[model samples]
Target: MKIAVPVVDDSLRMAGNAGHTPYFAIFNLNGGMFKTFALEGLRANPKVVVGEDHHDHDEHHTCDHDEGDVEHIKAHDTMAGTIEDCDYLVVKMACKNTAKSMSNVGVKLQKYNGIETSASKVLSELASQFK
Candidate 1:
């Protein structure tokens, strides 16, 4: 089975739809140890942004949903895809909406928010439990 976690810079867990990386560590039940990382592509769905009218003076300022925004959306899409392939996702925190999306993909969401922990450490502890 595989477990996934969302983190920023390896430790900091992001809230809401902010930028974050999904750490997917795959485990080998037969060998009873970690096998490899299963997350290569996974991301969130697109967010519908309301742009200002063309007559607005700030129209040249660019809307929040620009090319950069598209890139961010792609990241989330990759995350969702990766989670869909996983058995479960251990998240410190996630947007309420995103959690629902995860659920729709048949990926269980496990929350770990009480104590500070790293993905590797958390995965190790979970692995020990399976033994």
Candidate 2:
């Protein structure tokens, strides 16, 4: 199994928001062993400009199609694509819509408390869960 985690940098520090992270640390589980690899972050198509990076923007919308809305959806979709090969996505927090959209694409969402700061530690904990 493979787990995708949003990271702040090459060090693999967990990023609070998946869409805004600079990289994603993908952990591969084989024979109960895990290996870490990184992928460049996902960005929204340049055609859409989002003024602010808001994690809750999807929660406050009211049937309106604003520029940010388009960008938000596109960004999340791109994020989903980045980890589409993985079996799970682990994040500290993600907007409700983003999580739902990810679930639709067959990537299960695993929300971890911020207490664990490193991707390696988080992957260890997740590994224990599966065992």
Candidate 3:
């Protein structure tokens, strides 16, 4: 499983969407252990490749179509694809459209109320749900 946590420039979870979502802290989890080694603070790279193959296989999938209709097509596609691959998300707030789009891709949205949540606090809060 994987988790996608957005953050501000400060590395805290991101709060909202804007003209663009600049970056994401993607956690690559194996067995839900939440290992420190799995946390990756990914910066928004415009040309990032995100296809089913990029997530696993090595082939670069192709879309046989034009990209001009979508203004920020690359960025939007990457972000949405990344979110889709994630099983969990730590988000502050987002437009309903973004939320719905994410849901369409099976991303589980975990809305955080504030921006200053500590790592330990996050663990504690999540643990409570299981208890």
Candidate 4:
């Protein structure tokens, strides 16, 4: 089985929040051996938008899309894609939306409070649970 853990850095320290984590440490467990890799590209914050003053020129903003017309990009989208073959996701905490999105993709969620713990240690403990 495989497990995915959200991490803040390449060292595999757990992130404070799951959805906001920038990277995921994926562990592929085979018998007693495991291989790990880091997946990046997830953003913890939204892009900042700068507003322009209309007094300087004639400015017009128009949109043809409604609220439902736009597809919201949830954290799970990227996470799910990264760990698509994984069986479970272990994280410190996950928001409702993120949890729901992960569930929709057929990935189970495991809650862990070991944010300061190393990924190798966490994976070892998780593997023990199955035995």
Worst 10 residues of 1 by lDDT: 53-62
Candidate 3 to truth, TM? 0.54
lDDT, candidate 2, 1-131, per-residue tens: 77778766567777776545556677776663554334434333222243545342222333234446876677667767767777888877666655756886888888776488788788767665543
Strongest candidate by lDDT: 2
Q: lDDT score of model 4?
A: 0.58
Full candidate order by lDDT, most accurate first: 2, 4, 3, 1
Q: Write the per-residue lDDT of candidate 1 for residues 1-131, one digit (tens) a residue.
A: 66555543333333222213323333323343553333343243223222322121211232244345656555455556655766667655555445655777777776554354555555545554432
Error of 4 at 103 (Å): 0.6
The lDDT for every candidate, in the order shown, is 0.46, 0.64, 0.49, 0.58
TM-score of each: 0.48, 0.68, 0.54, 0.63
User: For model 3, where is the 10-residue window of minimal lDDT?
Assistant: 52-61
For residue 119, give model 2's deviation from the true position in Å. Answer: 0.4
Q: How would you encode candidate 3's per-residue C-alpha lDDT over 17-120 as one tens digit per residue?
A: 42134556666654334433266556552434423232211122223334463644544455667567777666555544455456677777775554355433
Q: Who wins the TM-score comparison?
A: 2
Write the number of the candidate with greater TM-score, choosing between 1 and 2.
2
lDDT score at residue 128, model 2, on the 0-100 scale: 54
lDDT, candidate 2, at 63: 29
**Worst-scoring 10-residue span by lDDT in model 2:** 54-63
Report per-prediction Cα RMSD to one decimal.
10.7, 5.6, 10.8, 10.8
